[model samples]
Target: MTEDRPSTVGVLLAGGLARRMGGGDKPMKTIGGRTILERVIAQLAPQCDGLILNANGDPARFAVFGLPVVADTVEGFAGPLAGVLTALDWAAEHRPDVEWVLSAATDCPFLPRDLVERLQRARIAEDAQLAVAASGDQTHPVIGLWNVALRSDLRHALVIEDMRKIDRWTARYKLAKVTWPDKPIDPFFNANTVEDVAKAEQLAALDGA
Candidate 1:
């Protein structure tokens, strides 16, 4: 990790219900002969100081990856914001040296290799409170950089304010939006269904996976 940039812990958000993918761990599904979670890890591991998985239910299912699995602090299957909060809290407690948490959905197999570097750079350049990734005119709130210091504020938003929308919460802060080219393939393409997984298989070849 670069000494100048704030230390960041990568958080793979696997807490989704995956209803569209037939109600199972979508990240565990295979793409290009490897699990999507595996692909996500391969892409993100090198960019962050450390990595952890935000997953609910029995943690044993993810033991093979050897990542520390943390369940959302809030109950009732809160949305992606909860996963973000979990990561921020985890980094604050488990990795005190880490000032930031980079959150990404586990289903995204083609996450950008320069994700951490770019997001950090953008946040610093804009002097923003948060930084998020965008592609082809769409912003991906779930895939972004978060400050560990915002854990309490996020928890209050989730528990007290009942804020489930990520965009709504992020709107409160000065957010740096960094857009990436969609040509060749969108770096943030995620597998949300069986068909998407098939598409990812083809895209994986293009990604040189």
Candidate 2:
């Protein structure tokens, strides 16, 4: 990071079992002639100092993205919270200067370009320890900002308490809710099914993506 912006890193959370979307990396699916992961990277890369992908299984699967892939230290597809913990640990080790990490879902192709800035601004204004993205009535907990300093506490929660729900853990902190409009297409619309991928394709076309 630089002196102008907050020292922050971006983590693409792709550590999920895509049972509904058949079986495979949902992010690898293409929308508008490009992989969803590519769209996520395109939106997030410029907003942070560095970017990494949090996933399990074979790291080679995401090699084309060329970002560091960090697997959950806590075993068993422990959900997005585990992925967040992995990013926190990775930041602590590789990006010690970065105090915050913005985690976004890989399947969300229309992620806003101002995601990091909005989250950071909300956290600062609310004096929050964490900030999550929201649209209309829905809250996307996986797409949030986490404090690197909470890595130790997060690891203990996952390893000791077996904490899997993101909301459950985030409740312990002063959390901020940063919302974006759900018009035309929700910025946080995630591709969890084949139908969603098609819808994303249409949305991508509309955005000239």
Candidate 3:
């Protein structure tokens, strides 16, 4: 990201039910002796001007992390789109100078360092309203760059139309898909199960080296 027009804030989408992981904050699980949320923050904090965490129910559980915990503005847990809308509304109201909000899952420990830079480059180059990250052939819809200008439409989709799927909403606009190599580790690999957490621990060793 360039300093010129790269004014972006970050929103960690932590509001997952985690039924596959036994129903708890999967991000709180440890990998390489650090919480996945910690690892996510470390990777994203430097790349963003500011950061916030999006989680539903008991914001107190995330207080120790020291980032503002935002909940879905729309009712009935409207999925990642609600989280993205929350981020956009927050950024629009609080960070007026920030034009873009980068949304990444909290459970992903190996997020790329160049995520923001590359996403910004792709969106700007393509003159796109949104940009999403992809690893090889897998696209991470929850992890993307959202323009603050679309917050109104997003809120409408979530609250009025009850839209939940991210791709469905993104399909309505110009979207840029930015791809990253899935080499030693996939940057968007998330810990959704106990087995995945174990795998992340092994990958953490590779990452530390």
Candidate 4:
């Protein structure tokens, strides 16, 4: 319950079925000899005090990751905003000291290393309610830092207003975007399909040079 790194819990939204790559967990897919989830968790673990995986059913498959598995509070696949909202609830109950929760999808293995620190800095500097990352003029709403206090408002909006896109809720509150240089044009890349997997492998090889 202290304002320390342990207060923040990194939430991995891993419930997606890789429709583009047939119908299975994309996190389980490999690139450059590591599963996407493995690569992502390695980068994410060092940035937070604790971590949890948000996905539906059969959490045993992800047991090797050694993080708690949570399911959506709402039943109908309401999208990433619902996942974010679920994470807020988890943060509230478990990591009470954490004023914010940092979240991202499992498929974005190349997420920035200083992701949590940068988003926190931006939120404080801009005095905003929400903070998300930007790369090469593209804003990633899923990779975000959210104030835990917004849980009630988000729930009300979802339940009553039937809002879906994260941007719609973000727009209602003050938001700040922290842009990362994409000179190599790689910060926000995601591996969503077999082609993307191949491209990511190639990009990683190039980046290692």
Cα deviation in Å at residue 91, candidate 4?
A: 1.0
Error of 3 at 171 (Å): 0.6
On residues 111-204, what C-alpha lDDT tens digit does candidate 4 reach at each position?
8888888887778777788889988888999998888999999998888898998888899988989899876846778888899988888887
Can you give the TM-score per candidate against the true fold? 0.97, 0.96, 0.96, 0.94
Ranked by TM-score, the better of candidates 1 and 4 is 1
lDDT score of model 4?
0.84
Q: Per-residue lDDT tens digits of candidate 2, residues 1-209? A: 43334878999999999999998999999998889998899998889899999988999989988999988888888898888888998998998888999998988999998888888888888889999999989999989999999999999999999888999999999999988999878999999999999888888889787
Answer with 1 or 2, whichever has the higher lDDT.
1
Candidate 3, poorest ten consecutive residues by summed lDDT? 1-10
Better model by TM-score: candidate 3 vs candidate 4: 3
lDDT of 1: 0.91
Best-first order by TM-score:
1, 3, 2, 4
Candidate with the larger TM-score of 1 and 2: 1
lDDT of 1 by residue, 87-152 (tens): 888888888888899999998888889999999999998899899999999899999999988889
